[model samples]
Target: MRVQFSIALAHLLRRRRSTLVSLLGISLGVAFFLAVSALMRGSERDFLKRLVDNSPHITVLDQYRSARVQPAELRWPDAAVAISNVKPPVETRGIRSHRSKLESIEGWPGLRVAPVLRGSAVLTFAGQQQGVSLSGIVPARMKDVSTIDEQMVAGTLDDLAAAPNGLVIGQGLAEKFQLGLDSTVSMVTASGGARVMKVVGIFRTGNAAYDEGETFTLLKRAQVILARPNRVNRFIIQLADPQQARTVAAGIEQAIGYKSVSWIEASEDLLSLLLVRNIIMYSVVTAILVVAAFGIYNTISTIVVDKRRDIAILKAMGFSATDIRHIFLYQGAVIGLLGSCAGLMLGYGMMHVLASVELKPPGVSDVVHLPVWWGAEQYLLAIAFAMAACLCAAYLPANKAGKLQPVDTLRGAI
Candidate 1:
């Protein structure tokens, strides 16, 4: 093995230029692979962070996956009654016995729960009318499952809890309606309920649509204004570990007989798009390594042709076919190991350059730097892939060199 290594080292050094070119090709290919992967994965993590922070991990709505069965259908499991003239019963909206359900859900571990009565209403300030979504929230529970408390501009959720008739509106709505803290505004609901409520808090989310059309109030106040007594229409849930959302949502839906949607379910389209993007990204980057492998193949093949006389002499000196193959394989391994180390250093430098670049997103005011994931797996992946490609590239040439005939070569020389 020492003799083979010494021979391999001598062969590589004899054709230093070709070996240098092969090393450069592999190193550059690996460097770019690392840079692109870091940026793509980093951006994905950033987007997910914002989504998990802003949206509920799971939402339990006052609805079922399918239609509800009649009481008679429940009573008679196998009875087939052909009656077509009966009119369907008109059911009231909102979840019944919401308090008991809330208590039951609160017993679950690793989750935060809050009940909300959401409705649509008309807002009139100084005789100008605008429509908005009104949400009734329990201040204590709302803070646990929502980041709205962090977006407050003038007042807090506690202010709404303190003042029963107080309403929290968006900053854009406040500006458009010329309303501010302590200003009186009239809220009108389709259920023939109307009240003049005070604007106790204002929030700015940087999203024009959300800021201009959403308002919040106390849970009891919403129940009265929406004309639904002792009921809630939605449960906002945030999990301690967001990865368990799908499982938790499924179990909750099965237990409660309501439609529970997890964040993964809600963002299926976006997630699919991200998946497609990753596939395309990997394909493009791996092509670089594949092209670099061709250089390795060419260098080894050229070395075999140039070293034929040396090979014959070694074969006459009692070197086996497998020993000859190992020599060439070791040459490829040396290039791969050296290239991987150089490539990693270059990739780290490139990542630092990318991370230093700052950009301001369209909706927000603050500037954030480019995201660059520094996961160790990417480094391992680059080296493993590069080494594998190089070895595969070297295999054919190594096998051919191993089968050389010393007698034929010596006869040709005579």
Candidate 2:
């Protein structure tokens, strides 16, 4: 092994220019792989964080998964009765026995639940009217599951609790209405229920749609205005582990009979797009390394051709074909190992530069930087792929050199 390694080292030292060029190619490839992968993965995780923070992990709506079946069908088992043209009765659009439902949800491990009575209403102030999605919530319970508390720009949910008729609105909505804290506005529900409410809190969520259209008030006030007493239309839930949302949502739906939607289910199309984006990213970056591997192939192929006599003499001098193969393989291993180390250092430097950059996004008051996830898997992935590509490139030349016959070479030379 020592002799094989020395021979391999000698081959590289003899062609320092080609060896250096191959090393540079691999190092650049690896550095780009690590840097680009870290940036892309960071952005993906940041997007998911926004999705989880701004919205509930799971939502249990008042609606059922399927339409209610007729009692006559249940009573007649094998009668083969087909009922036609039956109109379903109009029922109240709110979850029944919501207190018990809330209790049941909170009883489950690692889940936090909040009851919300959401309805459409118009905010009329000074003869200008704008439509908004109004939500009634219990301040204490809501804080546990929703981000409104974190997004508040003016007052807290406790202010709404203090004033039963207090309203919490989005910054865009308040600006449109020219309203502020303690400003009076008349809220008219679709059910013809109307109330004079005061703006007690203002929030900005950075989502244009929500910022311009959503409003929140106390649960009791919402019930009174929406004409649904002791009832809620949705249960907004958060989990200790957001990844467990789908399973938890399924269990909640099965237990309560209402339609429960997980964040993953709600964003199926977006998630599919993310998966495709990752595939494209990895494919494009891997191509860079694949191109770099060609440099290794060229260097090794040149070495094999130039050192034909050397390989033949080594084979004649008690060195086996496997030993000859190992000599060239070791050359690739050396290049790959050293190149990967250099690439990792360069990649880390790139990440630091990216992390230092700050940008002011539109509609956001605070300055933010690019999200960069520093995880170990990407480093391992870069090294593994780099080594694999290098080894594969080395194999062809190594195999060719090993199969050469000393007698044929010496005979051709004469």
User: Evaluated with TM-score, which candidate comes out highest?
Assistant: 2
Residue pairs with colliding backbones in model 1 are: none
* Candidate 2, superposed: residue stretches over 4 Å from native: 77-79, 361-365
| Distance from true location, Cα of 245 in model 1, Å | 0.9
Give the alpha-carbon lDDT of every model.
Answer: 0.92, 0.92
Per-residue alpha-carbon lDDT of candidate 2 for residues 118-235, written as tens digits (9 for 90 to 100) = 9999999999999999999999999999888999999999898899899999999999889999999999998989999999999999887898899999999999999988889999
TM-score of 2: 0.97
Candidate 1 structure, TM-score to reference: 0.92
TM-score of each: 0.92, 0.97
Where is model 2 poorest over a 10-residue stretch in terms of lDDT?
A: 76-85
Model 1 agreement with the true structure over 1-414: per-residue lDDT tens digits: 999989998989999999999999999989999999999989998888888888999999998888767777778857888434567668658877888888888889999999999999999988899999999999999999999999999999999978979999999999999999999999999988899999999998877889999999998999899998877899999999998999999999888888999999999998999999989988888899989989999999999998888888899999999999999999999999999999999999999999999998787778989989999999998998899989988888999999998888767752
Instruction: Give the poorly placed runs of model 1, Cα more than 4 Å off.
Output: 71-88, 361-364
Q: How far is 240's C-alpha from truth in model 2 (Å)?
A: 0.6
